[model samples]
Target: MSEKVISDYNGYDYKKEFWENVDREYEDQADRMAIRRLLPKRMEKFADIGGGYGRLANEYLKRARKVYIFDYSKTELAQAKEIYGDKIETKAGDIYKLPFKDNELDGLMMIRVTHHLKDMPKAIAELYRVLKPGGVAVIEVANKRTLPKMVRYVTFRSKVNPFSKEVANYKEISADGFYNYHPKYVEEIFNKTGFKRERVLSVSNFRSKTLKKVFKTNNLVKMEEAAQTALAPIRFAPSIYYKLRKPEK
Candidate 1:
């Protein structure tokens, strides 16, 4: 069998190059908002899977008694340690083979990490194995069937079919290992894994350069917050966030 294709960020300063330099405050805020809504208020143990440099640590730290930032990159974990200083524990490991034992975590989250995973089924099974019965997991996926992409496909501007369930690789246009998934395809995987879907949020609804140029960030965030739940059923956004729970029993 071939080895799994994982996105490595060892030497990369994702916090600086990806978040700070890119001016993606709107996307960042939107992500935080979605996480806050989904994450449980109180938990004994919670983890942020693939949480590089603990970017979303503040959101879960106050809620969970013990919070961990798990990633594959030691450099990113080191940076997280520097910023958090033991407030959050940092662990280095692969997603398919989590370090924790079965039913260990009370809650967990994976944001912007699923896109980098080539094997969704295997990765999600690991999430299921780690979470305790009735545990909550907030997962985010890069959506392929977004409104803009669908429009492009319908107008014959793009060859890729937005309605297909296959994973859409963006290596040609963007970074290697970057991928997008049809919402239904991901949902099917979650269902097969026995995770009960509780809530879905269509985040980053207005992620457009033109929209950012026209409106203030705060204004755009307000609109985004309103549209998240409203447009979730359609999964009309580029990023889809799901709140899932393992069955109690």
Candidate 2:
């Protein structure tokens, strides 16, 4: 890792406000569970790219012999080191510049991190570069084409165009700003990156406060599990999780 600042990550503190919101935690857990199911049943090594504090990659211990938690935050990596000392390897590296050599990993994950990336194709290619042929990658993307976004657009004439918006190119979340990608755009990214798409899981469908309050947490999780695949083709959820495999070329 070259210690270069990527995606306005120079001075952002994720440890503080990250765990503060209730819905955020629920949504995170939901994303983690959805990503977990897509992982290979067995693997020798895997890297969790941009996985802060090792919360998401920790779940990979059961499936992979060696688990690597890669992040851009040194403080968060230190905290992850403290939490998983000998169990996992923690690397503070930029997502644009992964520390590992080419085709060294049997599996990799990038959950809840793609939104921060300004160049989606480049980042996806980098991830594909590190993965071995026939390896699997579970990537979570914030969906621009979702039910709530479309409903609001039609009902209230909101500024958000969920149906056909490309990259927003703003500076809201980061200096380069974050992006909410349509599933079509994401599939295009995969197509250009030499990755074969397996399927898409529509995650975080019940992430709103009203839905959380109306249903128990367990029930919401159950509902999410049941509805994810059925809703994915239509892109009905706020988050879309893609399971992709590198072709054996």
Candidate with the greatest TM-score versus the true structure: 1
Q: Over all chains combined, what TM-score does candidate 1 have?
A: 0.97
> What tens digits encode model 2's per-residue C-alpha lDDT throughout 135-216?
9999998887777778988898667788785864436556656678888888998998899999788898887888877888
RMSD of 1: 1.2
Q: Each prediction's Cα lDDT score? A: 0.93, 0.81
Clashing pairs in 2: none
Tell me the TM-score of model 2: 0.90
TM-score of each: 0.97, 0.90
CA lDDT for candidate 1: 0.93
Q: After superposition, how far is residue 68 of candidate 2 from its true place, in Å?
A: 1.0
Q: Which ranges in model 1 have alpha carbons more than 4 Å from their true place?
A: 1-3
